[model samples]
Target: MNEERIIELEIRQAYQEDLLQALNSVVAEQQKQIGKLEETCKLLHDKLKSLARAEPSPGLADERPPHY
Candidate 1:
């Protein structure tokens, strides 16, 4: 191959490597955000569960409204 062709190939390879690194950084950041979201979901779920357990049921089936 000619020298010009070799230089072009090298430049293309360098650009590809830079693009790959940028994509990896973005993916890592997304993973961190996802981890935080999962933890928040779990905490919300646990809070809701605790609230449900603490509150007594209204037992509407056994009672009648004032309008009745």
Candidate 2:
């Protein structure tokens, strides 16, 4: 009975190790994706900033229709 119990424990440990490795891989992949998304957001933010600086800010609310 003791030998059987040891074998069972070993099997469980192996499965646990495999699961842990799979989880680690998934976490690593997610981290990489997060980094890419952050970089993309930064780039878009910079582009928007540049565009805002280049555009003229005309007040549309103060203008009346040409027909009036």
Can you give the TM-score per candidate against the true fold?
Answer: 0.80, 0.82
Worst 10 residues of 1 by lDDT: 56-65
Best by the lDDT measure: 2
Q: Candidate 1 — which residues are off by over 4 angstroms?
A: 57-68
Expressed as tens digits, the lDDT of each residue in 1-68 for candidate 2 is: 99999999999999999999999999999999999999999999999999889995668997888999
User: Model 1 lDDT vs. the true structure?
Assistant: 0.95
lDDT (0 to 1) per candidate: 0.95, 0.96
The alpha-carbon lDDT assigned to residue 51 of candidate 2 equals: 87
Error of 1 at 55 (Å): 0.5
- Local accuracy of candidate 1 as per-residue lDDT tens digits, 1-68: 69999999999999999999999999999999999999999999999999889996678788888998
* Stretches of model 2 off by over 4 angstroms after superposition: 58-68
So what's the TM-score on candidate 1? 0.80
